[model samples]
Target: MTTDSTRRTPLVRLRSDGAVDEATLAYARTKIDAVLARPGLPAVTGEVRITRAAAHHAGHPWAATADVRVGRRQVVAVAEEATGTELVDRLQDRLRRQTDKAAHYWDDGRGTTAPPWRGGELRDGVSP
Candidate 1:
């Protein structure tokens, strides 16, 4: 049976312009929820924040960062790509890698029991 923990994870989005329409937000939320719905994944806690980053240099395209808390650990994924096809392609590649890594880390019990933040020691700051 599916547990409630697996069903209550919330996905959140942060837009650069701070003017994201409902439709866009909904679409992003749906995509993220789909990803988190994978089997055997733990009940994720907190929301995944996706925000667009400013351009670093002239002619440089925009970038985005996805940060989320899985179990007791925080995972960050970043991607930068030019506008149009380049942007989409690059973001897809980077996001895929980031998600895969995060999934592996979370599922393999690497970050679940002994989080690296506390120097492998049990502490209040560390997540379960």
Candidate 2:
């Protein structure tokens, strides 16, 4: 995904596969924007594809997929839920976690002067 500095923050290109209502799409945009607007996040541009199963008896018909780039890191998250509300909720949570990890990629407790074998992290007087 390419970053567009001139565009709005959280530039989400959304696409739907079924009769998804405008309200639902708007709701998704709001949730996704909130996630992407967090502090420390890099310039992100991505797409979210929403699909609804047409089968009459499908339990979880709503599906959402997100492919986003956080700085130099790339994250792809997908989820399926029974309703639009649930779908967006899960999608935002996934996005939040993935972006958080990406934004803090350098602080993964690695490259430290002390390694785990050297009591870098001690608990109960024992190495964990």
Candidate 3:
């Protein structure tokens, strides 16, 4: 549905705590886009965070976290790796697993949510 004339914002947003290279971001985008492109997904929006650890953690400087929403459900993925390649690769796997799990729990063939008449959470009446 996307064409050159019309540009749409990416479904997944990317952010970094420190200097993350353009190449790395672009690669991350591609991986995340793949993960978010499920057939039954509805209005998926996500934020991916790439954090650089302190000097002590030089062996694994890269940390990636993705917070993704599928309809009313939310899933998070996190990874720590030695390089950008590893970070993104692990991120993709983690994100895919989390999203798939959410889908399994929430998505039914009917695509309809539970009726509000069913049940609500029981609130604790005890006060502090």
Candidate 4:
């Protein structure tokens, strides 16, 4: 992700196996932008991919993974629910926590930094 700070914030990339629609994508962007707008948070850029999991999950039928590039760092957040609820409600809560954690490494001292890409990997789904 590019981090000029002056450039336009990159659009969130919504990816699905033909399971999500334009409305859902729009809503996701709204909710995500709202979360990143919190005070003292870093300016974020990148894409969010939402995929429909095979019919075996619970809570939400959709699963989302965000690849955010803050300043020079990239941070990824992933969540899934077997049902359709507030995308931000089920996902942003956890994502917010992650942003908070990564904020500790910010260079601006005000938690204003970019998310790290780290080779395009999802931070939530990888096995340790």
lDDT winner: 2
Local accuracy of candidate 2 as per-residue lDDT tens digits, 18-108: 7677778778878878888777677777788888888859999999999988777888999999999899999999988888888888344
Cα distance off (Å), candidate 4, residue 10: 3.1
What tens-digit string does per-residue lDDT give for candidate 3 at 47-92? 8888776586488999988887976689999999988889999999
lDDT of each: 0.48, 0.77, 0.75, 0.61
Which candidate leads in TM-score?
2
Winner of 2 and 3 under TM-score: 2
Tell me how many residue pairs clash in candidate 2.
0
lDDT for each residue of candidate 4 in 1-128, tens digit (9 for 90 to 100): 11121112354444555356656656666677676656776666677666665566345677777777665567888887754455546777766777777665767754433334544334575433
Each model's Cα RMSD: 11.1, 7.6, 9.7, 14.1
Of the two candidates 1 and 2, the one with more favorable TM-score, higher being better, is 2
The runs of at least 3 residues in candidate 2 whose Cα sits more than 4 Å from the true structure, single-residue gaps closed, are: 1-10, 106-128
Which pairs of residues have clashing backbones in candidate 1? none
What lDDT is obtained when candidate 1 is compared to the true structure?
A: 0.48
- Candidate 3 overall Cα lDDT vs. reference? 0.75
* Weakest 10 consecutive residues of candidate 1 by summed lDDT: 1-10
How many steric overlaps are in each model, in order?
0, 0, 0, 18
Alpha-carbon deviation at 48 in model 4, angstroms: 0.6
State how far residue 75 of model 2 sits from its true place (Å).
Answer: 0.6
